[model samples]
Target: MDNRFEVAVSAGTMRSDSSAAVRFPHRWTPGGVTVEADFTGAHLLHLAAAGCVLNDIYREAESLGIDVSGVRVTAAGGFDTTTWQSTGIDYSVEVSSDASADKLAHLLEVVDQVAEIPQAIRAGASVRRASSC
Candidate 1:
């Protein structure tokens, strides 16, 4: 199996020489948090993975009668300074839950299994444009 997939993206704005108008599936505003990222271009990929994992955890926790109000997933990636190549990503998953230790661990395992974006990234799958006009 190739283990690869591709997708096409079309934007309404024309190619800009200096600036570009990017779009994201969801928009979030940080009221007082220091971390604020405008999901555009490559940043969207990171957001997708983090969001998927977070959603999975939240839903699973809810099913187990655990509240996930203050849960946060801090996803960070490192790039090689010389080559400017992406090295790897670190996931800092923090949650305030009342579930048992084993239940929480099980929930995390399920999160790993159901989160599609993170699974693709973990498998080292390449993302590229299928076609462009």
Candidate 2:
């Protein structure tokens, strides 16, 4: 079976200028709640990391037969204006479960090694801009 997946979101800027407003079609929470997308690029990047970790935790917990009641992951980072790159990307995960501390720690470590967004960032994926007039 093919386990690979591709996730996509569509966004655009109102203008080509430096002050152009970025817009997204919509935002959806894991609980199936939809909200307007009014966040910056930095905010979205952090969110992606957090979301990936949370999802992976659930997956791993399920495979380990661990019942997880709740999970929260917080990711924080900043972009250096001079270098135009991200820095200090850090995160914390809080999980509510009945599993032992050692099991939980092991699960977290495994997920951190395999989660997609953080891996991509760590690998320094090349980004290229395409424009049409």
Instruction: Write candidate 2's Cα lDDT for 6-121 as tens digits.
Output: 12221111111223333232222233211122376766777677667766877788788887766656677667766657765688777777899999999999999999989998
Model 1: residue 133 alpha-carbon error in angstroms: 3.1
Cα TM-score per model: 0.60, 0.70
TM-score of 1: 0.60
Instruction: Provide the lDDT at 50 for model 1.
Output: 64
Residues 27-108, candidate 1: write the lDDT tens digits. 2212211223355434555556666766677667767676544445666665555564556655656666567777778888
Task: Name every residue pair that clashes in candidate 1.
Answer: none
Best by lDDT: 2
Scored by Cα lDDT, where does model 1 land?
A: 0.54
Find the candidate with the highest TM-score and give its number.
2
